[model samples]
Target: MALRRLSTLLALTFALGAVAGAVGARTAPRMWADQLVNVTTDDLRWAKTRVRVNVDHWDPGAQTGLHRHPGPTVIYVLDGEVEEVFPDGKTVRLRAGQGVWNPARTSHNVRNVTSEPARVLAVHLDPG
Candidate 1:
């Protein structure tokens, strides 16, 4: 029940942010985040994974340096527009409220394309 409530809250927050971006509202330029979960201690006999949520405010004309993820990642575009670029020059554009799923071991880069900063929430689940 607690998890349900948290999920509902996140959904509402994302919805409002998306609507604000679509309307070009002033509220669309920033990012808001929830705390990280998966605080289990690591055990040698098993694999424990950590979960983290990252809210990013990507400045205009800004791009993320190349990075790697050893785990699966899920990201939501809360406001404005951003592009996820691959090493081969492929790009996936995310608009307000769009969600993306990245497989484990994926490597990529990102850039914000709009005049205003882009807001995004990244949920990462560590690999076993």
Candidate 2:
């Protein structure tokens, strides 16, 4: 009976450790991204383009460093609010139901200015 109790205690300890690890991983800072749509335009012979759509979730105060896309991108705010900074030092705030367009190869940075979580959907029209 004593040996059986020891075995049970060991199993419980292992299980608790696994659960704690999982919880910690979930709480870690990370960006959650989901690709919602992908399509390639075949009708245009000289200007064929690939379109990709994504939904991105940002943690509070998270920011995407300055980056540029291969093509124009349209971003719509889905929840909370975010600020977009252009290379010219201009900034704009977009909240839910509002969107903005960025020209191809436009350098910009997106940052979540809210104290709560935020989400946005982006549509990319890529030529390549």
Candidate 3:
């Protein structure tokens, strides 16, 4: 299906990015992401509840390495601007107060394109 093709494309893009990083062929600032909350439980049918939240900070020109989440992720821009890139070369610019939903297993990258540092709140839902 369409989703499968998109996932495959994203995986290839991530692989290429990883290779570029390993060879020092890329020039992007490193991002700092800190997990602020992680809660897990075991009760119902999807049976468990797991919430993973992270606060990500990026210096000017900094970016996150290509990565994917185990589950869908929601991101809210807290400060500055960000350029989000998808595996298929799609790009989006998000500003403060904006948000995005990242599909699970889809490779993507987030870049801080402004002069100031950028911050974003990321939340993930999981069943464990």
Model 1 stretches astray by more than 4 angstroms: 1-47
Task: For candidate 2, give the lDDT of residue 2.
Answer: 48
Give the residue spans of candidate 3 off by over 4 A: 1-47
| Model 3 Cα lDDT, one tens digit per residue, 49-125 | 35455556667887777988887776777667898899899998999778888877778998887887666666664
After best superposition, candidate 3 residue 102: deviation in angstroms?
1.2
Per-residue lDDT for 94-114 in model 1, tens only?
A: 997688889887888877877
The models' CA-based lDDT, in order, is 0.64, 0.65, 0.62
Alpha-carbon lDDT of model 2: 0.65
lDDT of 1: 0.64
Per-candidate TM-score against the hidden true structure: 0.64, 0.66, 0.64
lDDT of 1 at 58: 72
Error of 3 at 17 (Å): 30
Would you list the clashing residue pairs of candidate 2? none
Query: Candidate 1: which pairs clash?
Result: none
Model 2 spans with C-alpha error above 4 angstroms: 1-29, 32-47
For candidate 3, the 10 contiguous residues with the lowest summed lDDT are 35-44
lDDT of each residue in 12-107, candidate 2, tens digit only:
533443343334332314553331222222222344655555555677778878999998887877677889998889999999767888989999
